[model samples]
Target: MATAVFPYLPADELKKAEDESNARELSWFLDNLQEKLAEFKHGLEDCYARLSPLEDPESSTLVISTPKSELVKGHVTRVGTRVVKGSLHLRLKTLPSLHLKLSETSPLILPQLSHLRTLLNNALDCVDITRWTGDRHSAAFITSQLHLLHSLLLEAQNVLTGPSFPVPRPGTPHPLPIASRTSGEDGNEHNPPWYQCIPDPNTFAPPVPENLSLHLIPTTSSLILTIRVLEPTAVPPSAFNKFALAIGAQRRLEHDEMDGVFMWKGEEVKVKEKVRVESGGDPVLLVLGVKLQSLEKGIEGAMMSLRAVMGLSQEKDDD
Candidate 1:
């Protein structure tokens, strides 16, 4: 077996080898998830900072109550994380709302807020890879990235609402730019394999051949990964469906038909009538609806189209 460049192993031996490989991948995935969760927790602590003041005088407030009369107070509040109605008393030890965590600290610099909004663009780049870029990755790896992306986006949102806030912990302290040809996703840095044409977010992804279309849809409770099959009429659409079904089968998949490890899943969504699949994480749940485009004799090979949509599972929202 070692001597031949392309050697074949006995069936049972091959299956055993494949099993060992899959176990290793699964182990790696779980470790990564744990690492990311730890990072997320750390980010919550890191997210603490000051909220910038706004108009309505009622709009912004000191995120951290100093419990001092002389210090600037009241008339400042975040939209959702409002200031204590009348006055915050020194005697009353009230636990600030969880949203308060987002309001943490004070005196956030305008530049820092700008940086927070920038981090989101970086997350979008991470997402685009899962859709285009045609990278070869297992569902676990992609799903882990999605979770990280979501956590990071929340951090960025604090800044976007009234000011740009940092996802400081959920991702790298300073987000790196994804290669976006002349203009990078991070705005400053441009990476390799740069091209001239920018992808249109409104329409289905432009690259139609030999590529996987990844969709990241944020739901109330959890983020849902939607992988769209390339237009079946122009392409085979086999690879895309295999990815979707493989993810769906993971939740139970008694047959053990899939090649790799079983991983993340969440509340289900109906992709097609009577066809429900997990809403969050990968393997992403997608319904491949194939319909004849044209039956005319002149039509070449076959004609079909692929469609995708996102939904939430109320019982288990990521929110």
Candidate 2:
């Protein structure tokens, strides 16, 4: 028999090497876990700050209360070194609620909250990572608690900022200047061509007796007009066959169909043609567009003229 050039390690030595490798991996996992926990803790604090003002009873204007009658309760029990049970109650204002269960055994005793307020206070407090022993069980338990607390804080923030909460009323719409070309023959800043044209609200007429309205939105390159019919009824035999829209004489866009876009000076406006008549319940959506520069050059007068053609505006007879 000849001696082997390479010899296999004994079973005991092999097992020791395997154990050391696992220990190193576990240490890396614990470090990562601590970092994640710290990040979550910071986020929890910020969310709680945003929600705290609404929690004050004196801040009635900003507060939305969930009724006690709506509260739903759930419980989780764990049988381990020592039996532990936890209860959670949720009061939800909207449909669909939340439920949670905890089954893992924790190495350290977990904190208990007497009520929602206590839970929120605890979540807002700094997480003490010094107590974490870098053990897998401790990491799991801490992470789970942080996640639950984060969810609760998020829910509180949502409730505080929800649409049901009262908000300050908005003021009147302010007119914004049309976007102008920065450098062009027509765009001399010192002696710029008169391009500021405001739409005469007087001449602005929507489809009458048909529950139709028109809204204009101005952009950097063009003016967009949206036409909507609030009510759709069956089209009468005398319904207008074609819908025409124009902004500042750049070009007239005529469409007999339900929707189309009109282009002018490289700018486009869109409009919907179909009126929601009784047979067709779909609301008429017509979008139209025109170049912003065209609008600056007294294009509103052209729009008024187009309105007259569509029977949307009547020219006052100069008596």
Candidate 3:
């Protein structure tokens, strides 16, 4: 019996079994493909709905502000990646009290916008695939495409709520903020936008005075306004008085509110805003301790001669 036994199988029967197995595999793959296709279809529909509107131009009021100050304000009308009509308002005290009003009608494009949008659209283009053979490779392709679409979709959503900033107006001597800006009228090579007394803002902190540390982060999100006020125990000494940089002294008095004004650049800057006068005729403290202009219009204007400053690089937008 052992000698008669053979280890071989019938060729036709083996082939038939293989065919059935292949059929089952193919069927399973088709089911997986269908699920993937349905998911992709729904996702694509949603992505297009959001992205399509961005193609059409939109205009917005862009404000670059900090937790306690407004650094820049502008009216920007954008058509896709570049500003079609816009203006930048900058008030640097080193200048001769001139608020830089850089107006732009020419397009000022950012390189970032172009690259990001190109990547996003390429994902959209992937929808028109040559073919998927309903195999493992096709599944992988579908997975990769869907992953890309999902990633960009999330990134795009974060961009809609803007933390705005002032970009340089096109046609200026320097279209970028960090670039050395020559006076357009004078065309002098030696004259930079900032004054001689101040170190280049691109490299060093501006000439802000001591006592109050003026740190302008200049990144997308940071600015320091650490006011060095005297502690309450130290307030009575001759070195410091009730009014001079007293810590927590400027807390708004809980009394009848009054309006006041201080002069800046020949403009009557509004002050004493939301601050109530104390019962003893003591000057009500402001949100600002020693830094008086810590007032809204003041620090916001960054019109501070000794005040702090901050800014964000203007971001490129695809619409």
Best by TM-score: 3
lDDT of 3 by residue, 156-212 (tens): 332321123323333332222222322121112221121111222222122223211
Give the Cα error of residue 92 in candidate 2, in Å.
Answer: 27
- What are the TM-scores, per candidate, against the unseen true structure? 0.22, 0.25, 0.34
RMSD of each: 29.8, 30.5, 21.5
Question: Stretches of candidate 3 above 4 Å error?
Answer: 1-59, 65-71, 98-104, 130-319
How does candidate 1 fare on TM-score?
Answer: 0.22
Please provide, for model 1 over 213-241, each residue's C-alpha lDDT reduced to its tens digit, 9 standing for 90 to 100.
22222212222222222222223436766
Q: After superposition, how far is residue 89 of candidate 2 from its true place, in Å?
A: 34
Clashes of each: 20, 20, 1
Overall local distance difference test of candidate 1: 0.29
Per-model CA lDDT versus the true structure: 0.29, 0.31, 0.31
Ranking by TM-score: 3, 2, 1
Q: What is the Å distance of residue 106 in model 3 from its true position? A: 1.4
Model 3 CA lDDT for position 152: 51
